[model samples]
Target: MKIYFANGLFALADRMFNEVVVDKIRKMDSNIEVYLPQENGDINDKMNYADSIKIAQEDNKELLSSDLIVAILDGDTMDDGVASEIGLAYGKEIPIIGVYTDLRQHGVENPEKLKAVGSIGENPFAYINNYTIGLIKMNGIVVNNIDSMLAEIRKYL
Candidate 1:
C-alpha cells in the first residue's frame, strides 16, 4: 500500500514521524511506500511561504496518486498544508488514516473531544475532532499510532 504522510516539516515532531514512525512502518511491510514533502520546505532559511506552498502542492499531487494517506496530527493544531493534502485525498477518494500522538495530552479520551484549558483557543482535541469529522465524513479511518495506522491499511490492502 502506498502511504502519503502529512505532518509538520520544520520541527522535531516531523523528524520523529519520518525517522522513527515511518521507518517502523516500512520495516513492518516492505511493500508499503511512504511519501513526504522534500526537505528544504521550511521558510526559515531561504524559502518563502509561497515556495513552501508550491512544494506542498507538488507533494500533495504525489500524495493524491497514492492509495492512502497516513497523517501525523500531533501538533496543537493541524498543519494548514496537511489539511490541504487531506482535502486532496478526500477529493481523490483515498482512505486517510490520521496518526495522532497527542491524543491524551490535551485531555482527549477519544477522537471526538476538546480540552479543559484549550490552547490556540481550540486545543489539540479540536484538531483531532475536525480531522476525525473530515475523515469519517469521507469514509476514512483514524488511528493514534504508527502500528495502528499500518494495521488499518493492512485491512484494505
Candidate 2:
C-alpha cells in the first residue's frame, strides 16, 4: 500500500521518517510506497509565491494518490501542512496512522489539570494539542512507537 509519511519539516521528525521508518517499511514489504514530503525539495518557505503554489500542488497530488497516511505528529502540535494533509486524507476516507510518542509536550488549555484529561488509555500525551490528538484518534490509531505502529499495520492491513 502507498503510505503518505507526513511530519513537521522544522524538526527531526521528517528526517526520522525518512532515515528510520522508510527502511523499516521497506523491510516489511518492498512494494509499500512511501510519499515523503521532505523528499520533494520544491516545497520550501524560501521559495517565491508562485513557486510555493506549484509545490503545494505537487504535495496535493501526492496526497491524492496515497492509500494511507502515517503522520508523525511529534512537535508542539500537529504541523499545519501535515494537518492539512491529514484532513485531506480523512475526507478521502484514507486511513491515517499517527505515531506520536512524546510525553511532555501536550498543549493543554489548563497545563496542570488538563494535561492528562485528553488522554485515551495509556496515551497520556501530556503536552500534545487536544484537538489535534482528538482528530488523530477519531480518524486513526495513535501509536507510541515504531513497533506498535508496525503491529497495527500488520493487523489492520
Candidate 3:
C-alpha cells in the first residue's frame, strides 16, 4: 500500500517526528510504501531552490496516487500543505487517517475544563479547523494518537 505521510517539515522536531512515525508505519508491513515529503530533499531542502509550482506538482503526484494519507494535525493550526493534501485526497476518494495528538484535546470530563469554556480567554480546549476535520471524517477518521493511527491503518492492511 502506498501511504502519503503529510506533516510540517520546517522544524527539526517536526521533521524528526515525521521520520519516526513513518518508520513505525513502514515497519508494520514490508509492502507499505510511505511518501514523506521531508524525504524529498530535492524539493523540500530549504538551502536549495525549488519553485512553488515544482513543489506542488511533485507532491501532488505522489498524493494523488497514494492508497491512503496519514496527516498530522497536531500543530497550533493545521499545517497549510498538509491541509491542502487532505483536501486533495478527500476529493480523489483516497482514505485518510489523521493523527491529532494535541494534549489540550483531552480532559473532556473535567468539570473545571468544561466550565472554563463559558469564560472568556479561559477555555482549555484547543481548536482545529472544523472544515478540515469534517473533510477527513467524511471519508475516513481522526485518531488521537500514533497508536490509534496505526491501528486504523491496520484495518486497511
Candidate 4:
C-alpha cells in the first residue's frame, strides 16, 4: 500500500520518525511506497515562508492521493500544517492514523481554569489544544508507539 507520512518537519525527530517508520513499513512489505516532502535546500533561502507553504500545498495534494495517512501529532501541540493535512485527508475519505509522543492526554498544564468555556473531560485546564479532537473527529486511531502505528497500518494493508 502507498502511505503518506505527516509530522512536524522543523524538528530532527520528525525526520528520524519518518525514516524509522518508512524503514519499518518497507521491511513489512518491500512493495509498499511512501511519500514525503523533499528536503528543504537552498531554495528556502531564495523564497519566503509563504513560498514554502505553496510548495507544501502541492506536496499535500500528493499526500492526499495516497491510500492512507500516518500522521505524527506529537510535541506540545499538533502542528498547524499537519492539522491541515489531516483535514485534507479526511475530506478525501482516506484513512488516517495519528501518532503522538506527548503524554499530556490527562490535561495537566493550565489546570487552574478552562480556557474554552464549554469543555468536558479535564478541560478545565486543557493544554495543547486538545490534540485528540481532530483525530477522533476524523475517525483516526491515536497511537503512542511505532509498533502500534505499524500494526494499525497492517490492518488496512
How high is each candidate's TM-score? 0.71, 0.75, 0.98, 0.72
Best-performing candidate as measured by TM-score: 3
Q: Where does candidate 1 clash, by residue pair?
A: none
Q: Residue 15 of model 3: what lDDT?
A: 89
Ten consecutive residues with minimal summed lDDT in candidate 3?
A: 38-47
Model 4 — which ten-residue stretch has the worst lDDT? 38-47
User: lDDT tens string, model 1, 36-131?
Assistant: 553434432444555656666668667878987877666777777677777778877888787766645555464444444455565443435565
Q: Candidate 3 residues 1-157, lDDT tens each? A: 9999999999999989988989999999999999999999889888999999999999999999999999999888989999999999999999999999999989999999999999989979999999999999999999999999999999999
Q: If the candidates were sorted by their lDDT against the true structure, best first, what order would they fall in? A: 3, 2, 4, 1
lDDT of each: 0.67, 0.73, 0.95, 0.70
lDDT of 3: 0.95
TM-score of 1: 0.71
| Model 1 bad stretches (over 4 Å) | 39-53, 103-132
**Better candidate number, 2 or 3, judged by TM-score:** 3
Better of 1 and 4 by lDDT: 4
Candidate 4 residue lDDT tens string, 30-131: 767877653434222334444666767666667867998887777667778778788778777888888766654444444354364356563443254454
Model 1 residue 89 distance off true place after TM-score fit, in angstroms: 0.5
On a 0 to 100 scale, what is the lDDT of residue 124 in model 4? 44
